[model samples]
Target: MALLSYPRRHPSIHLLILSAYALFLLPILDGLELGGDGLYREILRDETVLRLKELGKVIAFSDEEGVRFQTTFLGSAAVAVQDVLKLNSLEGTANALGEVRYSPESVGSYVEVHIEQGPVLEALHYPLAAELVLTLETLCKEPNKFLTYDEECGCFTEESLAGLVCTVGELLTWPSASNVIPGQVNFTVDIRAMDDKVRETIVTSFSRLVLQRCDDRLVDCAVEQKHAAAATPCDAELTSRLERATRSTISSMAAGVRRAGGETPVLMSGAGHDAMAMARLTKVGMLFVRCRGGVSHSPEESVMDDDVWAAGLALVNFIDQNAVDAAAATAAESDVASGFARPHWSQAAHQFGCNRAP
Candidate 1:
C-alpha cells in the first residue's frame, strides 16, 4: 500500500500491484466463532497471485513486519493476517485465503527500501546502506530466576555469546504487585546474527543452559520458540548495483563530502522485513536509510529530510541503471538471434559505459 501512488508519479512504470491482504496487525477477539481455520486459508489469494505472476520484477517499499497496526491498550498481542481473517465469515473473505502455492519464476527479482532501525548509520553519519540479514523471537519461562546469576553457565560467558545479539524486549509476571514475589515469569528473547549457523548454535546453547540451570536449582523452566527465521542474504548482484546507486547519489549531492569509511557502507540488518518472504519467490535486495540514533518503533524515531531525499534519489538511480543494463542485454540477444556477430566484450563494455563508476 505504501507504493500505491507510484504509478501516478511515474507513468512509464507499469503494473504497481498492491497486496493489501499482506497487512499484519494486532489481534482483537470479541466472541466471534468461525470454522475453516488451518493452513488451507493462510496462503495468498488467487487474485494477488495472478497480479504477481504478471511482473518480471518487483520493487517494494518494505517496512518492518509490513504495516504495523498498533493499539494503545496494554497486554494486546500481535496476530498474523490469516488468524484475523479466520474470525470472520464476511463476503469474499473465504475466496481471498488459500493454501500456499507460488511459482519461482513469477517474479525474477525484488528490491526493498527501508530505515536502518539501528545506530550504525547515524553513528557513521551516512545516509544509506545495502543491508543483509534477519531475526528469531523466543519466549522463555522460568520460576523466579529473572535476576539469578550463574557463573558456571557457558551461555552466560562472553566467549559463548560472541557475535550474537540477544534482547529481552517483553516480560510478564504473575502476582505483580509491591511486596509480592512473582511465582512465574515469562520473557521474550530476540536473537540475531549475520550468520545462520552462529545464530542457531547460540540459541541451542542458551536454551540448554537455561534448562540445566533450572533443574539444578530445583525450579521449572521452559523455552518455547515463538518464531524463527533463518538469515536471508541480499542477492550479490543486486546488492552491488544498489551500493553503486547509493554512492553515486551521495557523491552527486555533495561533491566534496567525506564518507566515514571512504566508501558506501554495507550493513547487516538484525530486524526482519517482507523482503525475507519475497526471497522464496525471487532474488532480493534492500536499501536502508539512516534514522535518528538508530532508534525505531518508538516516538523518538526520526529521519533527516536530506537522508530521505538521498534514499529516493538512490532508488531512482538504481532503477534507471537496471533498465539500461536490461536494454543492453536485450539488444545483444537480438543481434545473436538475427545471425549477426555479437559485440566484443570490450566494445559492449564501452557502449554501456561499464568502465565508468556507477
Candidate 2:
C-alpha cells in the first residue's frame, strides 16, 4: 500500500499526530494491523514518526490497552484547559473539552481521505466529494423472543413483528436449527439522519413499536440502545481546500477519461468517521472517493483505481495547499502587525468574504 508522504523533512514547528492500532484489518493482514487507520498511521510510523519526533512531533496512539488513550489523555488535558479558561460546565463537559486539547502540539491542519459510502458520487458522476454534513447513527437492539417455528419448512412467521417504525437489519433467531423451533430472536435496527430531531424521533418511535409488537404477541421482548452518535459538520475553510485540491487533482488526472463537469459537489456523509472526533479541536477536511455502486461496509465495497488515484492526488494536493495557505496567512498577519498597509489585500479578503481589519 502506498502512503502519502510530503515534506521530505518535518517543516512545522510542532506536529501532533494521532494514530490507532488496527484491529479491523484481520481480513487483510494476519496479526498485523495493516488496514484502515492502522495503514496510514503505520506509514507515518515507518517513514515519519522517528524523523519528525526529533523535530518535536508528539505522536500519540489512540489505544494502548483496549482504551482510547488519546481520548482519555486529551480529555484530561481538556479538564485542565477548562480550569485554566475558567469555564465550568454544570452538565459535564469532560468529553467536549478533551477533544479540544487532544492536539495541542499541532500547528497544521487535519485532512482525511475516505471512500464515499453512498451512491451520491456515482449518481452525480463525480470522482470526489467534499463532505459538508455527517449523519448520526443510532443503533438499537431487540433481544430474546419466544417464537413458534415450522420444522419441515424453514420458515418462522411472527405476525406481531410487522409495522416497525424504522428499518431494521441483522435479525437473528436463537437456537437456529432446522430440527427445533426458535425460542428467541434478536435483531438490530440502525437509524441515521442528518437531523438530530429526526433520528431521535425514529429511535423513540421504533422503540415504542417494538414494545407494542411484544405486547400484542404476548411475548416478552428486550430492547436496548446500543450506540448513538451525533452529527458533526465539516470545517468550512478546510472543506474549501478539499474542494480545491480534489478539483486540481481531478483535472490533472482527466487526460484519459471523460471529465465530470461543474465544481466538485459538496456531499453529506451518511456515515460517521474519525473526522467527527478530530473536529473537536482543529479544522478537518475530508475527500470522498467514488466507490463502485456506492456499496460499503460489505464485501461488495470497492472503488476504481482511477478514483483511488484521484483521491491520493487530492490528499497530496490538499497537504501542499494547506502549507501554502498557512504561509500566506502568516505573511498577512506579519504585514498587519508590522503596520504595513495593503489596501488590495483587504479588498481581496473582503471579496472572498473574509474578515478585514479596519
Candidate 3:
C-alpha cells in the first residue's frame, strides 16, 4: 500500500504513515510486456502519451540509440504515491485519470520505522536511530576535465567543509578502452549533513570552485542538481516519547543479558526516505533498526531477529502510551469546555508508517 491512515476520535489528529514497501519500486516502462522481443525497446504507449497531454504534462523519451528501458529504483514508487494520494493535480479539479484518491482531513504526525542503511549503527553497536537529516544528490560533468587529477580533491579537503559526508557514487568516462585519455568525465556527488546551511554551503562552494577551475582550464563544465531536500527534524515531544519507549523495550530485553551502554545514539541518516517528503504534511519522526555489517540494498543485508522484535515491541509501547496520554488530554479539554476547572492539556493523535531507503 502507498499510504495507510489510522483515524481516532479526532480526525484532524489522526496519523498517516507511508509504508516502506510502497516506496521501494521504481516506475515500469510504458509499453513493454513480459516474453516479447520488444521488451528491449524503451517505448511509451500512444494512449499513455495522450493521457499525459490531456493532463497538461509533457512526456519526453530519451533519444539515445540502443538504450534498453529499465525501471528506476524509486521512480515507480513516486508515481504510485501520487496516484494513491491524488497529488500534483490541480486543486479543486476532478481527477480525470479515473483513479480513487485518498484525501484526509488532517494529519497530525508521521512516523517511519525503517532499517539503518549505513554502517554507523553497526559500527557503534546500536540497534536504533531516532533522528535523521537531509540528503542532496548532485551531478557534475566536464568534457575536457580528466579524472586522474589532484584538483578534484580540493573541494573535500577544506577545513570548513568538515562534518559533511560526500561520496562519488557514480562515475562515467567516455572511450571505455584502457590506455586512452577520457574525453568526458561525469560523476554524481551524494552530499548529506544534519545542517541545511552547511550542506548548501558545501554544494555552492564545490560547484563554484569546480566551475572556476574548469574555466581556467578552458574546459566545458556543467553542474546540475538532481535532487535536494531540507533537513527534517523529529518533533521534540514525539522523539522524547520514542526514546523512552525504546529504552524501556531494550531494558526489558536485556534483563537476562549483559549490555554495554544504556544510551541510544541519535544519528543523522545520510540516506533519503519517504519521511522527508511526508514532513511537508505533518510532524515527522523515524526509528531505525540496525542491519548486519551496515549493508543495505544488497543480497547480504540482514537484520537480527531480536532487533526486529525489539523494534516492534518498542512501537507498540509507544502507541499504547500515546493513546493513553491523548485520551487523558481529550478528557481534560472536554472538562474545560463544560465549565469545570481542569488543567489545560492537549495532544495530537499520531499516525505511523514505514519508509525504506531507495
Q: Output the number of the TM-score-best candidate.
A: 1
Candidate 3, superposed: residue stretches over 4 Å from native: 1-105, 132-160, 254-257, 335-358
Put down candidate 1 lDDT per residue, 57-169, tens digits, no spaces: 22222112312322111111111113223333333444454322234543445676656767777777788888655443222211112222235663444443344568887
Better of 1 and 3 by TM-score: 1
TM-score, candidate 2, is 0.59
- Model 3 per-residue lDDT tens digits across residues 1-358: 1222222111011122212101111112222112211210111112122212221222111101111322211222232234322343334444443332222223445565656666666766667667644343222211122112125564433444445568887799998669999999999887766557667877998999999999999999999986666766667776777788787666666342244666766656655555555555455677777777655444555777556656655665565555456456556667553422221111111111122111
Q: Can you give the TM-score per candidate against the true fold?
A: 0.62, 0.59, 0.59
The residue pairs that clash in candidate 3, if any, are: 15-351, 20-354, 26-76, 27-76
lDDT of each: 0.50, 0.49, 0.47
* lDDT over C-alpha atoms for residue 2 of model 1: 32
Which portions of model 1 miss their true places by more than 4 Å? 1-95, 98-102, 134-160, 254-256, 333-358
The residue-level lDDT of candidate 1 at 33 comes to: 19
How high is the lDDT of residue 287 in model 2?
71
